[model samples]
Target: MNIVDRIWNSSLGKKYLMALTGGALFVFLIGHLVGNLQVFGPPELINGYAHFLKSKPLLLWGARLGLLACVALHIASAVTLAQLNAAARPQPYATPGAYGASKASQYMLPTGIVIASFIVYHLAHFTALLPGVNGVGDFSKLTTTLHGETVPDVYAMMVLGLQVKWVCAFYLVAQALLFMHLSHGLAAMFQSLGFRDHVWWPRIECFAKAASIALLIGYSIIPVAICLKLVGSDYVERKKYDLKAANPQPAPAFVAAQGKEAK
Candidate 1:
């Protein structure tokens, strides 16, 4: 068998895959949090940032594709490892078990599945610029200027999307699940990599939990701020202007036909 197939078929290889992909995803979370935090800044800041990224189609898509692959592999490895452990673990002791393990660690698979579903909803809500789901003006029409160049107004999209109570609720739920998943996964990575020497393991776990909490707060604040009217107070006027500019009334069909006949 090929080396790739052999490695994939091995338990040790699956552990390594989980660890490495978890690490990649952890880094991505940090970067993503930083980007999301930019919403607290001026619209130009986040809008320009989004515009600059979109300007590089190749690099943008390359990173997205790579991240998608990592996500797939990480989920696959996690499920496979979970099944292996379950099948090998001959029906625990007769006494009460779990011994106070956190629910985050205990329910990794379910939480991961929910978080995965959230990712799709997130992509559609924000990245794909889908309308109706946002409960506001069409996201595709939400344009703003970046150095006089028109670009998708990410700032407006985020504010409007979160202003919807139900949408914000979903985001909060997703963030909670994401926090639990990250907390457990980070600690698991260290344990799987043989770092459970008892001396530094607790400290490592503490750091993981702290990191996850920080991410949770970072992501949670945006929706909360919008909901409170502290942010996006100008949403009404901004949406009207952007939608008008983006979707102006169509020219009269008879006038257009006459113009074409003249031509």
Candidate 2:
């Protein structure tokens, strides 16, 4: 068999693939979290950022497709690994506790499935601009003023979307599950990538836990802030700019008179 085929069939190769894809997705999460946090800033700041992304269709769609591919590969590899492990041990463990698996590790698969489902719902809720799905729809027509400049009303969309109590509750629950998944996945990714030295394992695990907690807080703040009205309840009035107010166009009679006088 060719080296590629051999690697494709090997457990180690699958682990490495999972680690690489998970790492990439983790980086994307950090970027996504940072962008989402812009909701706390002036409306135009986040709205302008959203507009900027939408303006670049090629780059935006390319990134979206790439992310989707990563998610598919990550999930597939995880499921494959789980099946392999299960098939290797057909009998149930007499004492499951003997493995000493962390709770996060034990629930990883279910949490991952939940997280994946949440991702799809999230896309439909926000990215797809679906109506009545968390009150998001036609964001292009929505506008808000910030620093005297009019921009897309992303802040309002976020606030409105999460204002529904059930939506917020669901979001919080999903985020908690995500935190659990990340807490375990991060350390496992490192170990799979061969960072398993006894000297640094403790430190790696500590970093993983800290990073997961930070991410959880960062993600949770959006819904929590909206719920507490920290981000405001009333929608900001859309700034309507009148063309005539900005620059008065000369009347037809005035233009005709001017032309007659010139003639």
Candidate 3:
């Protein structure tokens, strides 16, 4: 067989590429989620986390570049695989094929595509990189800081954004898709890397499901809390100082390292 055939035809080769690139993106998403969750604690906490990241310009940029690369690689491989799979089977099934599986298992690809669109819209709105503000999800707002920094209040934007029923609904749905994707993807990543065996498959799959559910719930709390008006922008101003005091270093290298090691 030719080199091109060898590269694409081999299951191990495809799985290897998917596993490594997917795992990298997964780790980044978990970290991003955790950082975003800081908005729940205090404005200062989230800003301080942002401040900490900004403090290391090089590392921050490096991470962004790395993430972009990983995402590009992951998306390219996924598209190629999907196309190949579609081409490999020309005849469409007469009816829906019966395969008993959980919701997470059944809709991985469709859900992932939806979530990917959500991510793009989300980044455009919140990150201020995208051209228009309509996609801002919910939190775009004008506000003043205690130190008199005139800035858009991200926490407020989140609160206000979620207050809109449609935005909240979209966010909740996207997160649900994320949860379902992770439910199976996590275990599949490990299995692809040869960490799986028949004895461990059941246990690993259970753990993945549980972890996915927990993360989904944790992230879902913010929108619900905001919708209820249980928490809002004032929470950040009240709690920023304490957060600033807690981790004055602003680099969080130790924390990031610990988290990676734990995983």
lDDT (Cα, tens digit) per residue for candidate 2, span 94-206: 76563778999899889999999999889977776555466433333445665586555777778777877888988999999999999999999999999889999999999
lDDT computed for candidate 3: 0.70
Tens digits of per-residue lDDT for model 1, 134-225: 66646665667788787878888888778889888999999999999989989889887887887898899999999999989998998899
Query: Regarding TM-score, does 2 or 3 come out ahead?
Result: 2
Which residue pairs collide in model 3, if any?
43-236, 44-240, 138-161, 139-157, 139-158
The model with the greatest lDDT is: 1
Give the least accurate 10-residue stretch of model 3, judged by summed lDDT: 134-143
Report model 2's TM-score to 2 decimal places: 0.83
What candidate 2 gets wrong by more than 4 Å, as runs, is: 2-4, 135-141, 144-151, 236-263
> For each candidate, what TM-score against the reference?
0.86, 0.83, 0.76
lDDT of residue 89 for candidate 1:
75
Superposed Cα deviation of residue 198, candidate 2 (Å): 1.8
Candidate 2 at residue 48, lDDT? 81
Candidate 2, residue 99: the lDDT equals 72
